[model samples]
Target: MHDASAIPDAPTASSPRAGHAKAVAACGLTTALTWPIHDILDPVNTVMLFLLTVVLVATRWGRGPAVLASFLSVGLFDFFYVPPRWSFAVSDIQYLLTFAVMLTVALIIGHLTIGLRQRADEANASAKRSQALYTLASHLAGAMSIENVRQHSASFAATQLHAELSLWVCAPDNTLVPATPDDAALPHQAGPDVARVMHMVHHEHKGVASHQLADSGQLVIALPLTGSTRSRGVLLLSPLRAHDPTLDRHRPLLDAVTSLVATAIERLHFVEVAHQHQIEANGERLRNSILSALSHDIRTPLTALYGLADTLTLIQPPLPDRAQEMSSAIRDQAMRLNRMVSNLLDMARLQRGKDAGQLPLRLEWQPIEEVIGASIQMLGMALQDHAVQVHLRSDLPLVHIDAVLMERVFGNLIENAAKYSPAGSAIHINAEVQGDTLEVRINNDGAGFPPDRLQEVFNLFERGMPESTVPGVGLGLAICRAIIEAHCGRIEACNPAEGGAQVRFTLPLGTPPTIEPESEGEDRT
Candidate 1:
């Protein structure tokens, strides 16, 4: 059960008639008590007792009541206590002075007492409002869903203001829909033509508007639900009791509640958005992992098939020309499939990266030219139609890198260049040490990457020439970027002003071990 007395009475507008009645009743009661003992007390003592009654009335009520009480006390004192009983006319001039002093003191005391009560009431009201807002904020902060916010806010309003309320949320299409309450703790205040009220609130952006709820035949108010960015919805509240004084007195608290509810609703909205994005991200990761595994598993069988096709061509008994041609075709197809599988595997590995806790690279110091040569040799027949040109500075420095991974990076770039360029075009490879970095450029005479899509080419499964007849899953450049980045290098694709696609990559030029000149016949370590 609630401690009803602890709940302070809300401040309200004073009624003149009610104040006057209270003042008369207080004066009458004081007169009746002192009449029997009029002779027992002197004039000064009698005045003091009446003044006390006036002060009590002022403290309990307000300025109007106190002022009325003050005048009534003076009139009653003059009529009964002054000489010549029951007469308005005073006989002695000295007694007139007494009446004058008594009235002045009572009025002054009443005014001061009323001012103090007003200040106290104002302070108490402020404290109550602050406590209510703090409690509402605490409840809102922990609320995770729209439903939780609605329930908490509704309960708080009903308890604090005795107001039955309903919440309406804005739909994505800017329409309002009722938030159905699940619990029966409080009654809903749905008004007829709720849409009209909501429209007015949204368009006006005003504080609050009053409307009659059809269900309860009570006055209901609509407050706009607004967040930091924009208005979200509307809140409807109806005082449970007819002509409820608490509603008008506590309008500020309701405004505060509206603000809190709007903020909570927006917060919940964004949380849901983030949750959806997380799900999509997880799904994408799972898909990539599955595809990577399938590609990796297919690579071994494709390699064996390619070897078998090549072996058929070199059979001990010379095969027919047709059989040889078929074997060549089989070997070419198998090789192409094997290359695709390798790209997929590299793409998967790079995508998963440290997220799967893979082993770190076996980094070693090696000559950059060696990695390039190994990459070209591995491509074998792929670059058969292209002329490969290697341009290395005479004093190029060795780079610290993972040799195998570096080979894969070079292989992917070379393969990409060969696949895009004309069959007989030259594929240029340039390498040199510039300052503390070793920069390498691979250029081919082909349609360069589109300007708009230059950056996107490095994204997994994104292709430079998406519409081209080139057979690939668009993982080559992406894998190249991953491998280069793993070595603390940077790779970029751009079209040279002179024409053709040119890819430039740079690796840090770390200090290499020097070979000490061996004494004659010394063993090598």
Candidate 2:
């Protein structure tokens, strides 16, 4: 909202129209005749004509014509109505006092009347500005998009200021990125120096004007768009003339427009960020639902297969050699199915944070080699055909973690490496302590992931090879991320220089506990 009294009224150009001139001439004629009849006409009547002439000058002829009418009234009074009529001499000194008092009164009244009129005009202009600002604010508040707001603002600015205007928004690097101006002939491209000037004004929350622009038949005014404590961008308005009074008069209104634009841009930016977060949350929920359905539908058949395989192995007569092979195949297939179900259930549990009770972290002085060996032993079947190499340092310190979850972390990574790579490819697992954290790298000799899918691969059900004929549901790496993040760690995937994908993760290393000295033995020392 704008204060009406703060707005400045613009001075209109002096009108030279003939009708106004004719009206002033008519009032001057009537006053000339009435001044000569003071002896026949009442003195009040003569004073009334003089006052009427002052009103005409003030309202129609302005200050110059009004002053001229005052002198003409004095001349008419002296030449015709004063003593010794039709002569330049006065017969009485008392009449001189009458002349002096009337002239002084007329001049004083004219000056005061003009001043009051000027003040009234100023007030009216101020009221118009307040209305314009209020209307602009209302229209912008209901805008649905930044484009709509920009267009509305641009048009309003041009119309109100009577100047060609352009708006530039700030890029991420705080550079002035100009919007496409409505006028194509005007240079829409802002140069490097112009951008620098705009940035300065935006940072300083000030206005910018240069004589270079003024001399070039164009005047550029950079008004900073600031909202609250943030500077949203800059508004560049180009007026036609260097001394355009209209533009100068509307400076406050322009500031109000810039403020409104800044507020809108900030509002729209937050709205977009919130919308994106909502989409991610919805996607996470849908992925969990699908995984749940898959786990339930696949587990029933797998349990039945496991039971039938065990029954076949215990046939009354020893099963034929071929039958035993078939039974073993059935059991292996059932185990693979069961592992898939377990992966789904584990993913659901990890995403929901339901496994917090199962993986209680116990801090102890334990060798990195021991933890690595435990993880490998659990993934033995998955890595049966793949050559696994460990590169653990002998002097590596023990890490504090939930031993069970850490094993699952390594199990998932190694399994993912194997699943993506061809059978017999070497899978290298290395752990090194680097500056207050332990960095683990799992590298394989398989075809690397597509560059575009590097980050997407971690999203649930998003596979590096979306159309691959692989057996898993693409939840392995996502589960790996959830568990690692739960442990206050970070993980990322990249293509290695050796033509395979490398998955790296970091875990913070706490101080290893020192072994307590053995208490004095119960046996005699």
Candidate 3:
């Protein structure tokens, strides 16, 4: 919450009774000044002089004073300047009509003059309001941060509305809190009942005159700072007086102020978002460079280590059985490490290609069954303990894909299935045609994926169980997703009703090359 409590009040108008007293004094002065010239000028001229006085009073003192001046002008004219002077009676009956005409004319002139003056005052107020908003916009345009927005907007509110403000900006978590806790205004006044205020702001998207919400009985108006896309925060404005009439009177200005504040806040939000993304992009680029370089450097050593370990197992006398077993284990571990490094290198290449708006895929028309079978054969000893099943139609169509990458996807899925499920658990692969797409599913019998995090499992380095004893980095599924999406396919993870983790992906089906029959006539020719 950002609070501006040190603002000074603007100048105000004089009291009503004092203003009316001045209007009466002006009328008395008018009668005294016009008395000396009554005989010198015609009575008609005298009546015109009184009407002029009424107009002046109406222009200066507003409606109430104008009304008082109108009645006083008539009484003073009949008693002092007209026939049967110093009395309410008029000797010539023609003068009675004069009295009626003079009084009626005076009241009408006063009313119209006062009304015209009011409209003038309203127009001036509107001009002043426009100028103030323009000044505020100028100040906010230069604001670079939320704090700058707060200080400039609060200063504007203080000078124009004669009120202080508290700004509560929305946090990234979608929670509304004070812009700065240390700067909260009237801790006893606004902070405690914030929950109620924020609820009205977030849901209703308007200001609420929450009169009874304050602890010290002060009124707090909660104005929602709503931007184009969402609510930015709440701006709490406190009027100068409790139950102040001007609170409602100045509501339009208050709302205008809220809109300006919301706009500034929104601009700052997007700027921060862009800055964060830039930082992350820089970090990601640097990380990929390091990983790619390291993968290339490490791959050669790992291949040499695997070959050396394999050669040791086939030594002349074949070493001892214990030595032979150790060599085999060393060979397997080196192979696994080499594959991991290769995956890292592949991920770097894919990321670079993605940055260039495409993937480096070597596409060809290949049988889906052949790719799946090749993947299974590549993971031979890894799948020895697990039962693997493949269910594909005899007439399954050829698919356009990057055979190497697709094989990697299948290999990763099958290896993950074998690693995650209990030893001897069955891994199932099935495929079917749906519309113009072929859907393939790989499932395993195991403690299924965490239900809540099904989609997050495919994010780079994200795993179903982060702390599990699985001995592989979580790149397999992520790489699979990247490769599949490059082929214009979609992938999803779920738990089947039979209780196991399942990953399904879809590839579009299109016309394949027609196979020509090599008939006997062609063979003889």
Top candidate on TM-score is: 3
In model 1, residue pairs whose N, Cα or C atoms come closer than 3 Å (at least 3 residues apart or on different chains), thus clashing, are none
lDDT of each: 0.82, 0.74, 0.84
TM-score of every model? Answer: 0.72, 0.75, 0.81
Could you give me the TM-score of model 2 versus the true structure? 0.75
Per-residue lDDT over 42-158 for candidate 2, one digit per residue giving the tens place of the 0 to 100 score: 765676687677766776656666666666666666676666878768888887888787788778777877788878877886767667767778878887776777777776765
Ordering by TM-score: 3, 2, 1
Taking the tens digit of each residue's C-alpha lDDT, what string does model 1 give over 135-189?
Answer: 7799898997778888878777766777777788787888777666443222355
Better of 1 and 2 by TM-score: 2
User: lDDT: which is higher, 1 or 2?
Assistant: 1
How does candidate 1 fare on TM-score? 0.72
Cα RMSD, model 2: 5.8
| Clashing residue pairs found in predicted model 3 | 1-178, 1-179, 1-180
Q: Residue by residue across 228-294, what tens digits does model 3's lDDT show?
A: 9999988877765655555556888787888898998898888989999999889888988998999
RMSD of each: 7.6, 5.8, 4.6
Model 3 ranges off by over 4 Å: 1-14, 24-46, 71-93, 134-176, 182-201, 204-238, 250-268, 303-332, 513-521
User: Candidate 3: what lDDT?
Assistant: 0.84
